[model samples]
Target chain A: MENESFYDFGGPEPEPARPSIGRLSTVVANPTATGVEAVIEECAALSRSLDGILALIVATSDGMLIHSTWSEVEGMRAAAISAAALGLGQRIASDFGQGEFHDSVVSTGDRVIGIYAVGDRHVLGVVAAAEDVTLGLLHLSARRTAQAIGRVLSDS
Target chain B: MSEIDVINFKLVVTGPFAAGKTTFIGAVSEIPVVTTETGTSEGREVKDHTTVSMDFGKVSVADESQLIELYLFGTPGQSRFDFMWDILSKGMLGYVLLVDATRPETWTDAAAIKAKFDELGDVPLVVGVNRGTESDVDKVVAALRLDEAVPVLACEATDKESVKQVLITLLINVVEQLEATVKGSI
Candidate 1:
């Protein structure tokens, strides 16, 4: 007795909208409370553990300095250069089909600058003396520190 | 579309390679200029290096007790690096194209770059003829076939005041254009 003509022609119903997940706001309404203290504390610890370290900076992917052990001008320059270096490195990696860029290193006569990828949106820049530190040791330390900083940045 | 509360403005300095765009931004920027200079492979004879990405500088303007921060971006002039031009110019209030007035051969390139910007959107721009004598201004203007309404003036990129004047002129043009846009909408 069911009327077949009344059957609906529409396809499978659209899946229920995924439940919205909460995240830290990208646009902070208040400038004073940015929750950056955790990252700063982590950077401070990282710097204290290393010998002959000139500077340690945590910066956003977009070149904003988050934390640094150096002066304001030095920190700002480190942040900017870190961002630029990573950008160029990423481009080179992608163009060459080299999966997963690790880090970039620039060694001068007296010092060495290392930029390591911290999470999806942060970078860790470390400047240290070239005389005392071996490249392997420097890279390993930077990698560990970057991973630790990444967790701090990712937590809500 | 109403964003009067925003006090930060971005202006792009674009032109052909070796046009003194980087020097101009450095001359007026309060902060240390950030540059991405790589060794030149093609034009080593003219200059040993060229900007691969962009140069950034920051300046502050005080108008009637209101503080406005101005960010200057210098574009890479090489055609191969034009991809960066799009990225730097986004949301920019205006731009200045610096032409090396002594090198008349590069005038057409400057005009072409301006035309490219024009295709992007209606943004105010001025042509600054740099490193040219006062007499070179007229010849440069004629060679570029500049429109009468556009401001073309001689500028020394190394001198901070000259660069500041050019920047101010560009800002004036931006304000006027913004007003026109608002009036038309109303």
Candidate 2:
């Protein structure tokens, strides 16, 4: 028989921990490797497929930029902001009893930024021209790209 | 003006990576903490997940005079997230710089962080040495090159009572600073 404490009465058991993807180390350790190249190619393909999209950035959950169409400094800053926004979105969803968080969109007068989860370990940020892109089209395109990116990462 | 019913203060808890900032806030906060934890690639050997954005928690101290609400904000320790430090420190009443006693190497990082926060504001600061004894206070002060007025105290981040003491000590310092400012304006 298992020893149970009074304090443990009727409490839900904790979920098992998920394994870390170690994506940051893998990309940093060998940027030119096949797997890293595949992720970069995915970002490039996604950018080419969308006309209104201005930039596409793929970053680790911890805000390290894996690939981006933007310059290095701008990409790094966007990646950090993406991580913070993703974290805040997840927390708000959980707190309000909303279902699993999918994506978040920030719209301005001239531009829109969409942050989406790529699997459990990475985030994808898409910046687009608000005048040229509809919210629905941006969502559909970004969601598909995010899924493809997730597959590439999982296989890698 | 009528007696103030509620007063809110923003307090930041910051230090080097894995210095128990999250645990310290969770120990004292009345609400469920909002944490932006993500898998760490660089420091995976030390800890699996790290705070990429920030951690938020809240506690209230009610006395006969007024109700004080302390909003605790914990920052990501890595320099890459240093931008969050500035964003979080805006309008902060004061801050607590927690350092891990077991890892003296991180004290240098702690010192650098202290210097950054010092530039951010003239707010009061208290250094809490986690997993340390009373004897560690002196060493921490000397290593951090802290001012003589900064209170350095040993604390266990996991202990509620210990965490409370650290906050209370910082609150006392904050009060003293406010008093000094009011007197100076006269």
Candidate 3:
């Protein structure tokens, strides 16, 4: 049951936010034998594709932020909370037999973001312009990134 | 009393703002309803991630032999939360669309709710024509194009007896549907 908030998905746009230093454990911009490095590159590229930046946060199954695109203003706190919620949601659904939790999307006109499950240990989060992107695109891009990122998330 | 098995079912109570979803849930729930106001939400003018999510309530029906655990989630009517509804409605059995009798246009939300529920499957609905004030009940019934069989009733969300009656009506309808399905399976 989906409700479309009668509001439009646009407002004063956010300044183009680039990943900054935070508790986010930045992975090798170029990955090695494991594909984790490649996934980080994809996360950066995915942000570039939507004319927005991405935040890739790895977390312990227990809801602690492991790594992120490391923003300057907003940090891993949001991702940590999101990962916790996603884990809870997945547990609730799986107890009832819903699909492998794909992702959670949170949007309001100014910006829209997604949280995805990469294997079992981490969530891949991305934010894009509300008007510029669609859920379909975000899901596809996030999954591709998760595929590579999930394999090597805990390696480092 | 027939042997009543314990079942976990999901149900949704939706309507326009101030239509009394929270009140209705409170009235029927056996436990004190717990809620949190978050900054993040959908369809509102404010789109901050910090805003809260929607409202929810739970009721346990333990009548001697029958123990049914029902989770009644109250969806935020504002447009932004619209995206969450699809995921919320999945696997739910019925919808209780609380309509404000005074706001005729609010029926539009009911239609939107019905269309979305239909996508999941044929869901039994209980359209509660919530009277904001003393109202001509007939007008509320006429505005809602309810099938001859669908249940439509007048009630006050804050009134305990009235709310329970509405729930009982729905429970009976669901049991009836299940009985039919069980018969067919035989």
Candidate 4:
């Protein structure tokens, strides 16, 4: 009675569900699986929904790329930039007693780059032409997209 | 009115994961260190937090004749954050590569990071073997394939004196390189 176990009532527990060989092969062949593809699709949808959006990138807080609309080299660069920007923003907020940082926007002569936190471990960067997108509109759209990206990341 | 000559130098601290770059900077910095640390996902068993982007700190050495300001920049140790390595290396006078003595498995990663920094520029580099003895220093030199000219010193990253010694060794190398460059110009 002191050493009673669930196995006593049901013999040995049924073998834990094993991944199918085909599924295992897919995972082996393409390490970036359906989850990554879903994240990429979310990025694409965000880019398509916004007018004059030049790029949308999802990157880990550590600067690893999850997905991006730009070319591989450009996306990697943007991912690093995004991570740095998010870090700096969070630092500034904490230092000044501003509470948790939500997002930051850098407006250049030709474009605006918005960096938004997606949950705690990820960030979403949106680049849009300054002339075509208003700051208010950009913020609204980007915040929504960031929330969506966060959901996809958590689900994955 | 007498004016003191002022000089500014940037020294980057980099290493493999959990090698103590942040601790080294925090121990020596005069100001509160500015860190970009995040909760670790993969290496949680070893460390609860890791630098995601960079850590910045400043220290000043002043004498009657001159004032030297050192801006210390620490980089994220993971390869995923290698992009920050290139960004932080800009305008750096020299760099210190730290290695953990207890974790031999990270030596390969440290060596790879060393090679990457070598490709980034011709800046002077010093290897600080943290929490290590003199024997460990020799092992680090061999494992990292360091040149005879490079300084490899045993250090405790959490100790101010030990961290200062590593910085002084690196500064010496930087000064030597500068002197050589000036001589070549002459």
Model 1 misplaced regions, further than 4 Å: A1-32, A60-62, A98-100, A118-122, A131-156, B1-10, B31-56, B63-66, B82-94, B111-126, B131-154, B171-186
Q: How far does residue B111 in candidate 1 sit from its true spot (Å)?
A: 4.5
Name the regions of candidate 4 deviating beyond 4 angstroms. Answer: A1-156
lDDT over C-alpha atoms for residue A9 of model 2: 18
Sort order, lDDT high to low: 4, 2, 1, 3
Off by over 4 Å in 2: A1-156, B1-4
Model 3 lDDT, residue A151, Cα: 67
Q: What is the TM-score of chain B alone in each candidate?
A: 0.93, 0.95, 0.79, 0.97
Question: Residue pairs in steric clash, candidate 4?
Answer: none
RMSD of each: 16.4, 17.6, 15.0, 20.3
Most accurate candidate by DockQ: 1
* Tens-digit per-residue lDDT, A68-98, candidate 3: 4553112323433454456556765675666
lDDT of 3 by residue, B79-133 (tens): 4556546544544567787887766776777667666666755667787888744
The lDDT of each candidate is: 0.71, 0.74, 0.58, 0.75
Candidate 1, residues B1-186, lDDT tens digits: the string is: 233233555678999999998889889988778777879989887798888887877787775544566668788998887766665565567889899987788888888898888875578889898997778888877887878888887999999999998998998898788779779999
Report the number of the highest-TM-score candidate. 1
TM-score for each of the candidates: 0.66, 0.57, 0.51, 0.58
Candidate 1 chain B weakest lDDT stretch, 10 residues: B1-10
Interface RMSD of each: 19.4, 17.2, 16.0, 22.2
